[model samples]
Target: MPVVFFAEGSAAMGPEARAVVARAAERARAWPGVPVVVRGLAATDGSAGFGRALSEARARNVADALVAAGVSPDRIRVQPRGPVPYEAMQVESRRVEIAIGG
Candidate 1:
């Protein structure tokens, strides 16, 4: 899985995130027939509704970034897993995971 980390409370992509996306794009280009899944995740700090909305927006932002990185929008799918509290550090939860599959 290629993962992009976001800054605290923001959906803006940083250098690290862009690098991850670039790598994912490269992998997508290498295997053009594969489907890329971009999973957006959010921290569990806020209300459920707020977290869901934020996660969805963050997911879309990641998908947009992937498109900007030259991956066809049609080849990417966005899945927002809202407010998963698995990460001990809240900041670590703010991320988008890109996985290539059939």
Candidate 2:
């Protein structure tokens, strides 16, 4: 499970996120013909609509980053998940998880 953490209300990828994306892309390149599924998740902040939009945007941002890192666009699938309540470490909820599969 490759995860990228994001700041509150932000879709931009920081240094750490970039590093993670780079690593994922490298792995993707290593395993030829495998499709990678990147799911973006965001914490609920009262509004479901807003949360969904944010999550989608975050997911797309990560997908774009991965593509820019040399991963084939066709090999990446972006799935944005709606806000999920987090009782502990809510900040950790603001993230995108990348899973590589065939």
Candidate 3:
């Protein structure tokens, strides 16, 4: 199992999105291939209900894809949202965390 943090490269996420992804990936290294946490970000009106749902769905899709790609369901996690820098993310998307013990 390998942990991979994924985020969209949308312009709305700003230039810092890559940096955020890198930091998340670094954090993920702690568990190697065991516990995987994925985070996705998108730009929307930040007020539409449908948009939020779509974002969450995208995140879940990524996580599920990872599983299909070879990761165990028990070792997969996902977190999705439209986040702001430095502030606590509202989790407008979703969060999934899994750890497969060695």
Candidate 4:
């Protein structure tokens, strides 16, 4: 699983995150028939509804990037795991993890 982090309150991915997604897309291309699971996560913000929406947006954005990178949309699954209970010190929970395997 490769994690791509995003700034708090935003669903956008930076260049480095996009690179990770690109690599994941390549791996998905290499192994046909395997499913790609993209889990979107968010920090413990004040509002649960906002957090859920943000996380979902993050997942869809990453999924779109994967498709743009040539991965088939049929093999991709987006799961938004709402905000975490707590944020780790300097680490925020705003991220989407790309999990690809058999």
lDDT of each: 0.81, 0.86, 0.45, 0.86
lDDT of 1 at 46: 62
Q: Which residue ranges in model 1 land beyond 4 Å of their true spot? A: 86-89
RMSD of 2: 1.5
| TM-score per model over all chains | 0.88, 0.91, 0.45, 0.91
TM-score preference between candidates 3 and 4, better one: 4
Residue pairs in steric clash, candidate 1? Answer: none
- Candidate 3 stretches with Cα past 4 Å from truth are 1-33, 46-48, 83-102
- Summed over model 1, clashes come to 0
The segments of candidate 2 whose C-alpha lies over 4 angstroms from its true place after superposition are 86-89
- Model 4, 1-102: lDDT tens digits are 888998878898899999999898989999988999999988764788887888899999999999999888999999999877655522547788899972
In terms of lDDT, model 1 sits at: 0.81
Please tell me which model should have the higher lDDT, number 2 or number 3: 2
* Best candidate according to TM-score: 2
lDDT of 4 at 51: 79
